[model samples]
Target chain A: MTIYENKYRITYEAFSKFSAKLSKANDKAELLEIVQKHLKYFFNFKYFRVLLKDEVFLKSFHVFHNSNNSPEFILNEFFSYEEDLLKNHIPIQHSSNGEFLNNYDQKLNLNNGKLWAWYFKYQDLQLCVSLISDDEKPFIVRDIEILNLLIDSFVTKYQQIKLKNRLHQKNVNLKNAINVIEEQKFQISKIVYNQKNTIEQRTKKLKDQNSKLAEISRLNAHNVREPLSRILGLLEIAELYEEKDLKKEIFEKIKTSAKDLDHILQDIIYKSNNAIEKLSSKTPPTK
Target chain B: MMPDKIKIFLVDDQKIANFITQKLLQTSNIDCEVLAFDQPIQALDAVEKDLPNFIFLDLNMPKLNGWQFLEQMQKNITSKVIILTSSSDPADVEKAKDFPQVISYQTKPPSREILQELILG
Candidate 1:
């Protein structure tokens, strides 16, 4: 193949590999790792760093990659330059300084390098990406397109993971709320059932007491008056007849009836005492 | 035809109640012929034949209670019935309301004043 066609063909092949690996990524770490591995094909940079925020999830991701090393994934950590870029919504291109490189020049093995950074807003996600390079392995303006594609694929997976976590939390919360309500309903029904039992018991006891009281009142009236009426009648007759007639005819009957009345009253007192004792003996009902 | 003197029948389970009531009738100076019977079964037969002016019937009895006597008397009940019980129980008084022939309900010891009012008045 000719050199021009080879370069175009290799570029297409690298992008296709990056897209396929990014699509298979399950999480944020996997997405960043895939991008770090394939990004070298598109550019020859010493370091590439990205600060990304998902506004919907309220989470920020920091992916820092040193060429020929595994990518480091830091959550919600941003450099001063990255913060400045985010605040100003601006882009920067300057000669490499430790401040722009977040004071990591000794580890990155860089001196007299060029630094490039840009801020971007895409569909509720804000991203600021920084690349460090020197004359030996220079990063051109055209390489920004490949960086943009890598960020887009990484963010898609990150947002999905965030949404899945949130959905699971919501489901757990809903289930617990339903369980609490069911437990409360069961307790309330138990209370109601106990109350019903108490009411029925009280009603039955009151009926028994009422009937007993009625029997006592009715019995006393009849029993007490049976002899009492006779005594009153004899006295009335005694008052009518002469004193001599009273002694023989009325007095004997009066004595017998008065004795009978005394016996009936004694019986009534004993029965009333027993009834009162029975009423007080039962157990008290619960609230 | 009406009798020459007022006839009062005393029907009760207690012999003493009938005796006391009969004596009260004598003491009251209300000139009435009093027929006293402890046995209500016999009293009902006598009452049916005599057809007295007033029948003073006691409530509680052995074979024939005052209510049973009243029911039996439904056929030949020409006389006025006076319910004479130990106590004027509201139940007894209310039941007496159903009998049109029962003119008065009196609680015993048969008072001369009550007897005088019933026969003479």
Candidate 2:
């Protein structure tokens, strides 16, 4: 192999190792640890940051390379340099320790800074990636492809976690909706059951009224009218016989019928007065 | 033929009602043998044994109403039946139309005109 081909093969091997470690990371904390451990092999930077945004959330992740370092994950916070890259969709640079560069100052950190930033998008995810480096540890143009590949793995893991959380939320919402429908069904059946009971009670009341009406009709037809009709018949037949014969036959029968009619009328009046009193005593009538 | 000796049956739940009908027929000078019964069961028995030329029946009674007695007599009833009820209810008159054996509907005590038409007519 030529010397140039051999140099490219070593770079490719280093990238593959870093990419495999990033893919194995299970969570955000693990992913950040893997990135901090493996990123130096791909490129040199004094500081690294990526601003990620989807439809609902905007996040910024940062890593400082001052030997005593940890990645910072901030929500809805961004630098002006990142804001400029996001809007312009252009690569930006600040030559020496400008406001755009990272400001991590300690006695052990001995580098003047230069800033480089770029805006890129993958599917629905918008990315603003920035790096700070100095003259001693330079971020070269040749390492851009390696950095892009690492970012791809990181963004993939983030999307997977977000999608899982959204699916869980959807399951919880579906359960609540189903419970509401079941409760409504139960309430409707209870109302129907109550209405059915009311109908039965009304039918019973109607039956009672029919029987009471039948009894009144029977008493009127037989007891009240029988004697009156008999008296009228006896009086009619009296024209056929002599006044002397009627004095023996018809007069006694007429007196008997009149007495029966008087007694039945008295009984009817007493019953009607009692019924009226009973009705007036109560507000709502009982069955 | 013994046409003058017509067998008349008075079947009323009330004894006084039957008595009134019999005396009214007697006072009207009709020549017929009148049989009266307050108990409807005894009337049915007498009717089955010797069919009356005319039957005067009341609508309401205990144990066996006029409708139920008519249903029993529906097998071979040939005698004309007159409904003799004190009830002024037109419903009874309307219901009596269902029985072809029931020839006339009358409210009691029946007027002398009704008896003349039913028996002598």
TM-scores of chain B alone in all candidate structures, in the order given: 0.93, 0.93
- What lDDT tens digits, residue by residue, belong to model 1 across residues A1-287? 98746765787689888888777876666766777777778777777777776653323433344544555655766777787898898899998744544544336666677888888887778888888887767887766777777666666776787677788889999999999999999999999999999999999989987997888888888988888888887777676778888778888788888889998899889988887787667657556
Model 1: docking quality category: medium
List residue ranges in candidate 2 displaced over 4 A: A1-43, A51-60, A63-137, A140-175, A211-223, A241-248, A251-255, A262-287, B1-4, B13-16, B27-29, B38-52, B62-80, B88-103
After superposition, the stretches of candidate 1 with alpha carbons farther than 4 Å from their true spots are A1-164, A284-287, B1-3
Question: Number of the top candidate by DockQ?
Answer: 1
Candidate 2, residues B38-68, lDDT tens digits: the string is 8889989899998988999988888888888
Q: What's the TM for chain B in candidate 1?
A: 0.93
